[model samples]
Target: MDMKKYRSTMKRILGCISRYQWGVAASLACAFVTVILTLYVPILTGRAIDCIAGAGAVDFPRMWKILKQIGIITAITAASQWLMSHINHWVTYRVVKDIRTQAFNKLEILPLKYIDSHSHGDMINRIIADIDQFSDGLLMGFTQLFTGVLTILGTLVFMFSMNPAITIVVVLVTPVSLFAAGFIARRTYRMFKMQSQTRGELTSLVEEMLGNQKVVKAFRHEADAQEQFENINEELRIWSLKATFFSSITNPATRFVNSLVYASVGIAGAIASINGLLSVGQLASFLSYANQYTKPFNEISGVVTELQNALASAARVFELIDAKPQVPEDPDAAVLNNARGEVSLEHVYFSYNPEVPLIEDMNLKVLPGQRIAIVGPTGCGKSTVINLLMRFYDVTCGSIQVDGTDVRHMTRQSLRTNYGMVLQETWLKSGTIRENIAYGNPEASEEEIILAAKEAHAHGFIRRMPQGYDTVISEDGGNLSQGQKQLLCIARVMLCLPPMLILDEATSSIDTRTEIKIQKAFSKMMEGRTSFIVAHRLSTIREADVILVMRDGHIIEQGTHESLIFQNGFYAQLYNSQFAV
Candidate 1:
């Protein structure tokens, strides 16, 4: 929508293309050769006609030789076109691959809040559809535009040299037609941009529906989902039609203009021949050049339409590529090594949005090897604390320190490497159980993986499966039970053996018996590790060295479990409500 932004994106795209300048040069050379060959065809036809009319003993052998030469030239032209296409494809694909890699790297560095604000479907569309569209544009659009321009220039020079009167008639109509074509192209481009955005929205809607298919079935919301999809689909169709209509108009308008100019050239050439100003061979040659000259305008109009479409796609793709990550580490930040696990949050205040503070003046200290449990009502900043500690979001005020070093002063990789985390929802890629366990510690030996699995109490169950530790799991561990998925996460964390651990509702989904089994494994994993637990079930955190109760962006209470129970405060009330028989 913004012209400045569009210009900036174009600059970036040009810069990317400049990286493969040699390949682009080779492609352009091939396009020029093909155009040159194409222009020679009309001249050759005119020569053959002139020879036939002269009646010079009818040189059939010479005619055959000329025909063979034209055939050879045609074959070479085809080969040149093919080479140009392959080169364009190679360059476009390489640039697109680099763009995708850079986009993903940018995503990795961006803060969690950026991802939270963007939809999964929209991002996926940019990565897949937008990039694919850009590739198409760069490959086909470049070749067509370059060749069309070259063909037009070569034809113009030859036409004027053959006969200026006919050349002028044909040339006079070109600017008006080009101006009309440009206006139509601009309208089509705007429609194309809107169509791309709407398609992304449609893709997002379908993804959401499929992801929540269980919810939709349970609530019998099939009709609602269908209606929502139809709305987006209709909008997409309208935009698509507008783009198609405008693009379709350009070719017909161009052809009509070309027809008018061709008629003018014929009439003017006939007059010159009648006035004895031009010979029959010259008149015929002028008409042939007239057609050749008009061919480029037709080619230009078509290429302009295609380029408009490609440019629209390029603009969308570049918008994402140009987005700056929300969080950036200092260039001089140092990597931490052998970090002591002592963490302190000093008078910290933070918010995802500045208007709504999620955590305010939060102060806490965790001694090395101490296990602290954070209990709170939903949306009471329990998870926000973990986010801040991990530097997923920076504090708006005060500071957080790990081992007396400011977190902001340390490299993000170093800070994260010192801690291990187990989330409420277990996520695993489609791979063998062994691969998932060794994900955090890629260099961990087979013996170490087996030991970690044994420690997490996952060895028995995994061995019972068809492939034992080598059994393949679906992405997100869909093939495994909820309990088994949690165990896999635990084994992954255990393999890392980070000094600091954060267990975020780790047993929230397991049954009572499985919870007990997991809790025992968790206790072993937590030993001598500085750990933070966010739990809704009070019984699970009863043995925590310290418990902090949080509410409405503040710490409401802090004490040991026994002391809090004796005090009969928020923690005690929550415990009585959940644990009472």
Candidate 2:
């Protein structure tokens, strides 16, 4: 519906195609040759038939020469078409490959907020399904589209040369076919666009349901889920049918109009032949040219349908590619090297939405090796603080500095690489346990990986598996228990030996006894390293040098546990509530 987006999408598709323009140019040349051969062969055949019609006597030598020419030209036309098909296919697939690569690379640099806001399954469709449709239509359009146009043009020029009167008849009826094709194409495009979007919705619904099958079964919502899926599936089916119906009408519409043109040319040519204005052989050639011209009208009408489908797919892909990244990294950003773990927030202000300000003019200073614990009720900005600290979302005002330099002045990768993080949500890729642990520091040795695993109490469980450290975990570690997955994630950070660490309810999945043991291990690990601990269980941070008690996005109280308990404020009451049970 947006003309500007349509133009932009077409321009980008053209750009990808132009990468192999030399090949495309060669293919076009082949197609042109094929068109000429097609026109010439028909002329030769018609001339042979006219030799007998005119003389009423067999001109054996002349007829044989004409037949020979026809045979050779037909062979050449077939070869030229083959070349065209080959070149078009090779160039088309390569262009598609480049497009997919660029799209995937764009995702890597895209802002997290964009990924979070967009449906993941819709994105998958753009990457896979939509691109495939675009490729198929593009390839067909490339070869057939150009060939049909040239055939029409070459045939028209020959028709005019032979008989201008019949040429006018051919041109007059051409508009009817064009009009029909254009009308049908417009409606088909709308339907195809709707179909593409509906397909994305269906894919997203499937992904969401499959990912949360546990919740659906636990809530006994099978029938409800099936109904929802059916609703989306039926919507996709309706749009798909409508699009197919509209496109299918095109070939028949063009055929009906073209048949009128074909019939008129035949009747007109016969009259011209009766008179002496056109020779018998020439009139025969003219009829062949008329058939040639009208046939392309049919082929091109079909191509129009394909072109619309391609453009619809291209529009979706270009929209995703053009999405602006979260925040651009500074060209002259500082490189953080061997950071000493000192962090300071100065007059910071932040909010997910500017109208509803959350963290307001906040200030915090952390020493190089201090163990800082941040505690608060749900939605009290506990996680927002970490998000800001990690520069996932920058402070709306003021600055967060690492080691003496503003975090904004450092590259995100360099800044984040220095800190190790373990969250309650454990993420494990499809790889062996050894690979997961060494993900942060790929160069870590086998000995270092084992030591880190042992410290997390994961070494024993991992060794008991059939393949030990080489056991490949399924996607999301579906084969492992929650606690085992959590331990593997912790072991990953332990191997990194980062300059700073953040534990965000990292032990929530483990049993109480195991959590206590891991807590002791973490306490030992924190002897000289700076750590940021976030917990609902205040008991875990009993030995923290400082505890920040947050309420409504501000630190309502700040001190050691004994000091905060003596104050008998929000921190003391919150700590007391836990033991009340």
Q: Against the true structure, whose lDDT is highest?
A: 2
Q: What TM-score would candidate 1 get against the native?
A: 0.96
Enumerate residue pairs that collide in model 2.
Answer: none
Q: What is the per-residue lDDT of model 2 for residues 1-581, given as tens digits with 9 covering 90 to 100?
A: 46776677788888988889999899999999999988887678777877788556878899999888888888888999988999999999998898888789889888766888899999999889989989988998888899999999999888887778889998998899989998997788778888999999889988988988889999999999999999999999999999999899988898899789889988999898888777777777877787788888887888778878888987888778888866888899998887898999999888887788788878899998899999999988988999888888888899999999999989999888888899988899999989998989899999999999999999999999989999999988989999999999999988887788899999989999999889988988887878899999998899998999998889888999999999999999999999996
Error of 1 at 503 (Å): 0.2
- TM-scores for all candidates: the values are 0.96, 0.96
**lDDT against true structure, model 1:** 0.84
Cα error of candidate 1 at position 482, Å? 2.0
Give the alpha carbon lDDT tens digit for every residue of 340-409 in model 1.
7899999999988888768888899889999999998999998989898888888999999999888999
Candidate 2: segments with Cα more than 4 A from true spot:
51-56, 277-284
